[model samples]
Target: MAEGLFRFAAADLDDVEVSSAGIAAYGGDRVSPETLQILNERGVGLEGFRSRMVDEGIIQQATHIFCMTRSHLETLEALYPQACEKLYLVCEFAEIDGEVGRDVPDPIGGGRGAYEQVAACLDQAIAGIIGFLRGTGKGQAG
Candidate 1:
């Protein structure tokens, strides 16, 4: 979903409104402690963020919805059939290894090492997705 939002927010892009949602998020809560630590190590400060729920309002607003996993997509598809066409797994867009139908895993309950691995994967995938969007003329680097 990061790529979708970045593109939508891109200065030269048009016709898109991007947002993220977790069907059952730890609503109004902060990002995971380990996730923050990992982001910090990468020089990304996210202390201001407060996790929000992925509700119908969010779905209603987004034009192209991206999720981290298949379960997420399936759940949303089942619950919000009208919005299914907009739902997708962010990684699937990379067209890597026929992964066009899979999802990124959640490591929130895992150990510090798991957090590190997850961060690394996220960084790689997000970078690739953004690059794809840019190459497709969706957005330029800001």
Candidate 2:
């Protein structure tokens, strides 16, 4: 969801490259039907989008790496200490409903409502992310 939203939101920017990978995902797995529905409702399509696991190549190429939870951050940091400087929680740039430092809950298997809530959270966070990137003059790549 974050990947699709970021790609749609940052579509106008040529310098930014948006991609999503999971810390525990099998390559070529399809996104959940709920995810497809939510994105489709927002006019964002995830056609040909298959899941991929995070690897050294992805880490080395990213200018900024946003994780959904602190656990994810810890995992990535432990595995790729050299990229620690670029690691960040996706919601770090914005607060959801006046709350700060909250993990963007994983909606997997939680049904449609859960997915909807996550999409809303990602919508706000993605906007803040764009603002942050532009403000820092680091929108060249991500």
Candidate 3:
């Protein structure tokens, strides 16, 4: 969801590489139907996405790593301490007031309404992400 949202938000920008991975994912698994449906409704394509577990190479290549939950960040930190400096929770970077960077709740196995709520949260966080990227001069704000 973050990858799609970031891509949609950064469509007009250049030289930005946005990707997503899981800390403990089953490789080759397709995205959840609920998520696919929600993204389709929002016009974010997910036609060929496959699940991938995070690896050392991915960690080394990423300039900024946004985790959906604090537990993910903790796991990555414990497994790849070298990449800790660049890791962050998406909500934390978004500076969600009074929220203490809560995990973007996973709506897996839930209905469309749950997916909708997750999408709304991702939309808000993605806006802040774009702003942060632009403020850092990594890409232009469009």
Candidate 4:
């Protein structure tokens, strides 16, 4: 959901590359139907998208790595300490419901309402992410 939303929100920017990998994911698993429906409702379709496990190559290539939860960030930090400087919570740049630094609630298996809530959260966070990228001059080619 974050991947599709970020790609959609950042479509006008050519230098940014958006992708998603899970810390505990099995490669080749398809996105959930609920996820597809939510994104499709927003006019963002992630055709041919499949789950992947985070890898060293992905870590090395990423300029900024945003995690949905602190647990995910901690795991990434333990596995790739060298990339600590690039890691962040997805909501680091935004405040949700009058608070900052909140973990994006994972909506997996929680039904359509859960998915919709997550999509709305990602929508706000992704906008803040775009703003951060542009303001920091990180979204453009050097």
* Leading candidate by lDDT: 2
**How many steric clashes does model 3 contain?**
0
lDDT of 3 at 70: 94
Report, for every candidate in turn, its global Cα lDDT versus the true structure.
0.61, 0.88, 0.79, 0.87
Which lDDT tens digits does candidate 1 get at residues 63-89?
Answer: 667677778888989988998866667
* Model 2 stretches with alpha carbons more than 4 Å out: 139-142
Model 2 whole-model lDDT (C-alpha atoms): 0.88
lDDT of 1 at 89: 71
Residues 1-142, candidate 4, lDDT per residue (tens digit)? Answer: 8899999999988778788999999999888999998888889989799999999988988888999989999999999999898898988889998877789998988999999999889888888888888876663210
TM-score of each: 0.74, 0.94, 0.90, 0.95
CA displacement after TM-score superposition, residue 39 of candidate 4 (Å)? 0.8
lDDT for each residue of candidate 3 in 82-109, tens digit (9 for 90 to 100): 9887887787656454574779988877
Query: Could you tell which candidate, 1 or 3, scores higher by TM-score?
Result: 3
User: What C-alpha RMSD separates each model from the true structure?
Assistant: 4.7, 1.3, 2.9, 2.2
Give the clashing pairs for model 4: none
lDDT of 1 at 25: 73
> Lowest summed lDDT over 10 consecutive residues: which window, candidate 1?
1-10
